[model samples]
Every structure is written in structure tokens, then in C-alpha cells.
Target: MDPGFIGDGRTVAVAERSSLTFGVEEEFLLLDASSGVNLPVGDDVLARLTGQASEQSRHEFRQSMIEMVTPVCGDLQQMREHLAASRKAAGDAAAAIGAQLVAVGATPVAEAAVSRPAAERYERIIRQFGPVALDPALCGMHVHVGVPDRELAVQVCNHLRPWLPVVQALTVNSPFHAGADTGYASWRSIQMERWPSLGPSPYFASAAEYDDAVQQLITAGVMLDEGMVLWYARPSARYPTVEVRVADVLPTVDDAVVVAGLVRALVATVTDDIRAGLPAPRLRTSLLSAAHWRAARDGIEGQLVNPLTGVLSPAWELVDDLMSLVGPALTRDGDLQAVTAGIDRLRVEGSGAERQRRIHRAGGDLHDVLVYLAGATTGSVAR
Candidate 1:
């Protein structure tokens, strides 16, 4: 007999309105404080944060990476507070171990030996994926927004496909890899796309169709389990939420919050559209993947393939369109002002990748890049 379906009977609770509640998960590179090299100190950091008020810090695939998940937050402000507290606590722990937590998409230094975490699942990945499994020395931020039911969650994931590249463009913070500038805004995206499961999720007719595909992948041995989907967006395996996994770990806390708020507003907009009988866009997955590639290559500094028109246009113009698409939801959540201000600030200051390039051009080395990243991760600018 075939294995049982995992997401059966998941439609028991349908949310009539968007809860607008959300959370954020940020992954950070642990760096040696003195040398700015990637350091395998995540175990020490997790041990320090293990028995705190809540289980916030967790070990990622690589020992040089740590991840923190915030509690469910009602608004952008609450999300900011929780992220700030978590970053500080983790920073403190890392500092005690002669390491620093750096909010960067990829480490500038090459890893001589991949440091695998002690988890059996991680070991399995290492054994299965070879070099690609160790590629997550890069970091990213995932935003989780609540949905009422699995069906709606899957619909939101479908509706969210086209807009994901815009999200990636806004959060492209990785411009360097292996001790030199790779020139792409997010080299991490390039590294991650090596995995078969990573990219825009295909449209599904229903929640069952989605679950069936996941089970097929498991049965085929391409993935270990449902948790390995790693699509640009997916229904959270653990929570009643749709997780957006397209963004890099931004350099600043406020940037992270702005992205989270935008994602929440997008979900609200999509859910409302679905209720009004609007069908999700039927773009092909190959086109969606191409859009993501352009976004990662150019970030906000160059052209983006428009999700709606499929035309090459200025990245900022696409971002403006994105803002307009979710404007009503932002107004409903009272986050219009914060998100608008954040966009304005970002426009003036540029994406984190631009900022890193500027620092590197100013005669600063990779160690200097690490210092800047560490300071920005703590909500301050360092130059």
C-alpha cells in the first residue's frame, strides 16, 4: 500500500478574512570576530539561547549558520521588536564565543571543510546532495503569514508565484562569494537554485494536488520529506501559515520588518482576490524561474522581468507596481506609512548589496564587510 497522504483533512478551518498576523525567520552567518571568516560557532549560540524565555535560536544546515524564528506578530512594530530582541540575544551569545553574528546572504570567504551540524537529517542531506547541501553557508530570511485553511494557504502560494521575484530583488544583499565580488546582487540565489526543489512552486488544482506532488517527490527519493520543498513559497509544514522563502537575510532589522509587512499585505490582497472569484495568474513555471534569475542578477539596480507584463523594466518601477498591488491591504493593516517610509529610505540608501559594494570599493576588505554586516544586523550602520 502507498504511504498515507500528509495534508488530508486540512481544510477544516477556513479563514474568512486575512488575519494579517505574521512572523519572520532570519538566518545569519557566524563569523570569527577577529578575522571575519565563517566560524562554526552556531552550536555555542544555540546552547546559550536554548532555555531562554522561548526557543528562538536554532541550528541551520551548516554549523557556521544560525536561524531565529520570531513569535507571531500582529503588526510591523511587533515584528521589529521580536526580531531585534532575538538578534541581540544571539549576538551576545556569539560574542561570548569569540564569534559575531553577521547578517549576510553569503560568506565572503571559501569554506575549506563543510561543517555539518550533528542532526541526522543534515547528515542525510550531506550524503545525498554532496556539494550543494553545504551551499547554505549563505543565509536568508523567510516570512510566515497566517492563513485560515490549507486550501487557502495553497491558493495563496499559487497567487504569490509571480510576485516572488520582486520580493527577491528588494532583499538582494549578497554581492560577494569566496572572498571576491561575484557581481550578482544575490549569489546565494544562484547557489540555492542548484537544488531541484528550489524555485517558483507550480500551480496546483487543489490542496490534494499539492500534497500529492510532495508525496511523489518523497516516493521518488528526490527529497527526504515534505519539509524539503524549499519552493519560493509554500504552505508551512508546521504552522497554519504560508511561508515566503524568496528573500535574502537583509542587512537591517527595519528592512526585514518592511519585507515581512509587505508579504503579509500581499497575502491579504491575494486572499481577498480569491474570495472575489479572481483566478490566480496562469504563468508557466519556467517563466517564473527566469524572472527570479533576473531579479537575483540585477537586484534593484537593473531591469526586472515584469510578472504581469513579462517585459523588461526598471526594478524600481516593478517595486512601485508591487506597492500599488498591496496598497489596500497595507491601508487595512495600518502599515502604509511604515512601509512607504521604508521604501523611501531604501530608494535613497539603496539595497544592502549596493551598500556592501560601496564599502568594498572604499578600500575595505572582506573583514570590513563582515564588520559592516554585523553592525547592520544589530540595527546600526557601520562604516
Candidate 2:
């Protein structure tokens, strides 16, 4: 399929084969179905997905969790339906072995005191990454939205820096770690940054500049490679997509779809704006981190740093405003209803993080979280 974003010239191009190809990867903690604790279940699940869905379930560093990669979905609705089917396949496969699937950027219950997952690759990763591996409090859902050209991918990544926090605020689900509450919405964001490349990337004038920056980070031990630079926004070397690595794991498949819609709309909107000669906002790197910290620390309870100006703003208010910012792009790209409707649905009921906290407050145990995971994972998309 022709890439959706503009070519190397930075002009927005009509997506040829697919309007916009997206790949959604959800990182899940595998728990002992009977015990409600994390363990290495990735290898077995990956093996199962091979014959079943096949080629989509690849290995992640963690043993206890599986990363489900959906096929390139051209639009938001297709992305939702494809992801829903993929999750179903993974859930049924995991259930056969007394394990269950979960979605969260960080699994608050197991992150602080991670019990080993059964996979050998995870054991290898643990041995390779010592203290960095111990927190066990992180899980993340990554969405890759396709861009047409290598240069365009780099440009979109550069433009994407300021908006990263918006998704972080929207998807903050992890609020507890260890046996006690961590007092943060998505503590996993901080924990994942420990891996070297965990935040926004600097401006890349061209693809070569992007590559050089990636190389320097690796040489400086800031990153192992382009892959290790797990920035909130980065151009994928393998696919013609820029992956957004913010959003905490959703409690349910429906929540994941909501996030996916916003991500696609953001990319389309920004890409279109750039093509129209509207410059992408430029904020200092430090400001980006502050916004992230606020979102991680407060969830929806406190105001977050506005990405455009670095001013503190209420999370709810920010959501309403951001929806307006992306309104035209969402409509032009045909994701308007999905994106707006998704956010509206999320606001009315509550977020996955709120539900997680509520469950903990009522029961004060992992049992309720586990039950929430199971019920959410197995059920159909909520209306």
C-alpha cells in the first residue's frame, strides 16, 4: 500500500492503497488464572498465535506478557474490529493453559514485585537488564500509524513531540505498584524511560539527521539502537509508520480502540497541517517531560502542562480543547465520529484508570483487578 503521509518533500499525499495503515500493539501481563499473579506466558502464547492468527504475535522482552500486533488496518473502525478479533484469539489461546490476558501500560499489581514469566527470552532480558527489570510495574500499548515516505515519517515524528502528553493523560490506567498505591496514574512511563529512549526525539531536518541522532544515542549508551530509543514518538525503521509509545494499557479492548482513533486522527491532522504550510509547534524537550510527569502523577485528578505553551491545564478541559484542535483533520480523514465519539464515551463512564482505582479502593487487592481484566478481556466491545 502507498504510504499515507507525505513523501520526502513533506507535502501530504493521498494514501494510495490504504487511506491510513495502522498497527496496534497491546502489551499484556499474563497471570496464573487461578492465582492472579504474573508469570512468563509469552512464549507459549506467541507459539499459539503463529498457527492461529500467525505472524502477528512477536516476542517482547518480558516473559509474562505477550504483545499482540494487529495487521495493517486502513481506518479506525477496521483497526477496532481487527484488534477485537486478535484479542479474542489471544485470550482463548491463553485460557487453554490456565493463563489470562490483560491490557495496561503498567500492571500496577505485578510491576513492583514482578514474579517471573515462563519465557526464556524474558529470563535473558532480565539477566541483561538487572535492576531495570525489577519494577515489574509497567505495561504499554503502542500504536503505529503509517506515513508515506521516510522523510515524512521523520517529519511527523518531529511534529508529534508536543502532543504526546495528551494521549498519556487520556490513557493513564496504572495507579498502583507493589502492595501499595504508587500515587501516579501511569508510573510505567517513568519506569520505561529507564530503558534509555523513553520520551520525545529532537527535530530531525531529514531522514539522515534522524538516523544520525539514533546512532549517536546508541553509541553514547543512551540507547542500544534505534529500537531501544522507545520515544513517545519515533519513526519505525521496519515499517513506514511512526509509533506513538505513550498511552497506558487500557482495561478493556474498547478502551484500546478509543486510543487508536485519537492516535490516527492526530497523525492525520498534523500531517495535513504540515502539508498546508502550518508549522508544527515547537516546545522545549524539558517541557515535554514536565507534561508527561504531570499526567503520570495526577491522571485526570490534576491539571497537566499544556504541550503548546507548557501552562498547567485541567485534564478534562484539555481533552475538550484537543478534540476541537483535531476536529477538522478528523473529519477530512474520515475518523471524526470515531475519535469524538470515543472520547465522549470515555468521559461519561470514567477511564480505565478510574475503574482500576475504584476496584482497588473497594477490595484493596489484586483479586478485583484480575477479575476486571478477565471480564474486560473476554467480553465484546461495550456499547
Backbone clash count for every predicted candidate, in the order shown: 1, 12
User: Model 1 reaches what TM-score against the true structure?
Assistant: 0.93
Q: What residue pairs are clashing in model 1?
A: 108-179
Error of 2 at 111 (Å): 7.0
- lDDT by residue (tens digit), candidate 1, 283-379: 9666788899999999998999976677999999999999999999999889999999998888888898998888888876877877888888876
Off by over 4 Å in 2: 1-18, 50-52, 111-129, 380-383
Candidate 1's clash total is 1
In candidate 1, position 34 carries an lDDT of 72
On lDDT, the candidate that comes out on top is 1
Cα displacement (Å) at residue 248, model 1: 0.6
Model 1 lDDT on a 0 to 1 scale: 0.83
Scored by TM-score, the top model is: 1
Model 2 worst lDDT window (10 residues): 1-10
